[model samples]
Target: MIAATRELPAAGYAPEVDGRLKAEFTTRLRQAGGEELKRRFPMLRIRIYDAQTHAREEI
Candidate 1:
């Protein structure tokens, strides 16, 4: 399961604020979930980059 952290810039020195990695993670989990259906569904990140982009465009 994925756990939320209060720290910034994890071991990879990646940006902790932006949700790029989170989105990528969710994308991958969706694939894994497709394969493993019997067990509990894994926790995945849900970053809304598309919505943010549309919001900016509207503004």
Candidate 2:
């Protein structure tokens, strides 16, 4: 499992907005250059965090 944290500015303090951004980032990570890593580590797990809300999500 890989744990990561991203600090959001004031604009992303809202849960809805931050959630959307996090989702987008996660999508991009999976689509952009993550294929090779996934292929090699099929059981890989990613945990994302939002510093603003201290929200945590696993993808």
* lDDT for position 20 in model 1: 38
Write one digit per residue (lDDT tens) for candidate 2, span 1-59. Answer: 97575445342222222233333232224334344545676676544444456664554
lDDT of 1 by residue, 19-45 (tens): 333322212232344325323433533
Among these predicted structures, which one has the highest TM-score?
2
- The estimated TM-scores of all candidates read 0.16, 0.32
Scored against the true structure, residue 10 in model 2 reaches a CA lDDT of 41
Cα deviation in Å at residue 34, candidate 1? Answer: 12
lDDT of each: 0.28, 0.43
Runs in model 1 deviating more than 4 A are: 1-18, 21-41, 51-59
Worst 10 residues of 2 by lDDT: 11-20
- Cα-based lDDT at residue 16, candidate 2: 24
Window of ten residues with lowest summed lDDT in model 1? 50-59
Error of 1 at 21 (Å): 4.9
